[model samples]
Target chain A: MMVPVRCFTCGNVVGEHWEEFDERSNEGDEDPEAVLDELGVDRYCCRRMLVSHTDLVDVVSPYQ
Target chain B: MSEEYDVEFVEREDREARFLVRGVTPAFANGIRRAMVADVPTMAIDTVRFIENSSVMFDEQIALRLGLVPLTTPPEGEFVEDDTVTLSIDVEGPDTAYSGDLVSNDELVQPADENVPIIDLKDGQRLEAEADAVIERGKNHAKHQGGVGVGYRHLQRVEVVDDLPEFEEQESQIVRGVIEEDGELVSTTEFDHDLSKRYPGKEVRLEDVPNAFVFHVETDGSFTIEELVTRAADTIEARATELEDAVQL
Candidate 1:
């Protein structure tokens, strides 16, 4: 349920950048585009990995 | 006789690089690409044993995630292929278990990116695991692939043919990879991959440079770009030698 370790399309490691992307995009007002760009995540496939990830780990962990 | 090859780096970085190689056939160029993708060896979690599992996620799921986490591969001779490195993690509830938390027995081999989230433990849930990372070739499993993205294209040579017809709307001509103009290498990105933009109001002829190829390689942090490339070249050489010896015998 956690962020995937690699992009579904390109297999690039995007999990490592998830925490910073979430923190900056949610806490600060920085644009997600700029944040992804700054993180050197250029491919649309890799970008989708961060934008579309739903951290269901917290949601599912409470059940079991 | 050995053929002399010329190599020029179009762009170089820690994890990725683009280089132009001359004096090689398309098949030889493809061989280099294939070797980089499938022959290079790197460390990846091969077997994971769970000491405790109170989290919601299944042990298998957690193991898959751990296997995907890129680990820093030490230099050759430090560990041979199939050598195993031990790493264990223990995290209690009210917190998350990140890759950084994995305690590795080998200092030289650790997680390349620390922030990779393995799982999130709730208030009382716990996750403990001991994994054996084995050095293996990408041919065995994709998780061991050091070169995540490896590809090449023929080097294009652009020649200005003549001026475009007056008042003619110039259609967008897209050209990717690197191009050679006036004996200088230029990446297509420099002109936004649009040939019309680089040569305005003019017709241009694009031709492939015989025996020249441009390769773009990106690694998964298991190793440096230089190491990935050189190791790939070494693999090819070794294979060629083996073939020669077999034919003689």
Candidate 2:
């Protein structure tokens, strides 16, 4: 049997059938948004929703 | 003031090879480019190319796991003189990482380049068990286009003092290790560049390495964790067979 793999970021199933949850588990549970980062993909920004100071720093401003 | 902008990556109108980033002001875009440049670590001169040009794609979650500072958007740019984003990538610096728990070092995040587990020969298993740990490590390293880099071992052969004294004419093999001017394995042999002055008792000769000695992985002048382990195993096995063949009276 295949082990279910939750998205690294969202901790949610990578994908699933919407109504097949009666016997399976939680349904309509939206995977958390990927917390965008400076380096690369955020495969772990699930449900926690922690805002970051660096993420809000002078990113829009131009560096000298 | 904080400003958040949606980064739209678009291919350049002219340069097919290079893509252009739109929606972002030149200053913001240049700042992002500079940020990537800073990521080169000590290889500050090393260049980073955002192939997509318009939008940069990456898994930010891993970046956080690595404890790297984030520069999401809003006041993003080279502004906010108080705040700075430096490239925490270890390889960019003057030194490259090796196979060890070096990533946890406070100075930089240099994770082990390779993880080839060496099975203890004394474990009483004939032939040897599957190199599960290291075999898997090698496969992982082979995935990226980088595959792996073979760092030079720079092994030096030393002549045993007692043997040298007894048989001034006969040649024999001996173990060698790096020692400081004070005679210590504190650093790489290369650090003993001034061998003559530091090691007054004996000079460590760099040119005395053996040809059969597996100093590197293969063609590349670099060393890999797997290569090192394999070389060591082969050496031990060969020595054991040689000893078996020798009818020591």
| Per-residue accuracy of model 1 over B101-156 as CA lDDT, tens digit each | 98999988999989888888888889888999999998888888888768999999
Instruction: Mark the 10 consecutive residues where model 2 chain B has the least summed lDDT.
Output: B127-136
Report the alpha-carbon TM-score of model 1 versus the true structure: 0.94
Give the per-residue lDDT digits (tens) of candidate 1, residues A1-64: 7889998766689998998998998677899999999999988999988988778776665467
Clashing pairs in 1: none
Candidate 2, which segments miss by more than 4 Å at Cα? A1-64, B1-147, B158-192, B201-206, B212-249
lDDT of 2 by residue, A1-64 (tens): 0111122332222112111321222324532232123212233442222221112112421321
Deviation of model 2 at B218, angstroms: 14
DockQ of each: 0.75, 0.01
How displaced is residue B173 in candidate 2, in Å? Answer: 24
lDDT of 1: 0.90
Candidate 1 deviant stretches above 4 angstroms:
A24-30
Tens-digit lDDT string for candidate 2 (B1-249): 034433221212210111222244444433333222221111000112222211111323222222211111111122322332233222221221112311221222122223211111111211100100101112122211011122222224333233223434432223333322222222233434444333344423444232111121111111232333334344345556889889676
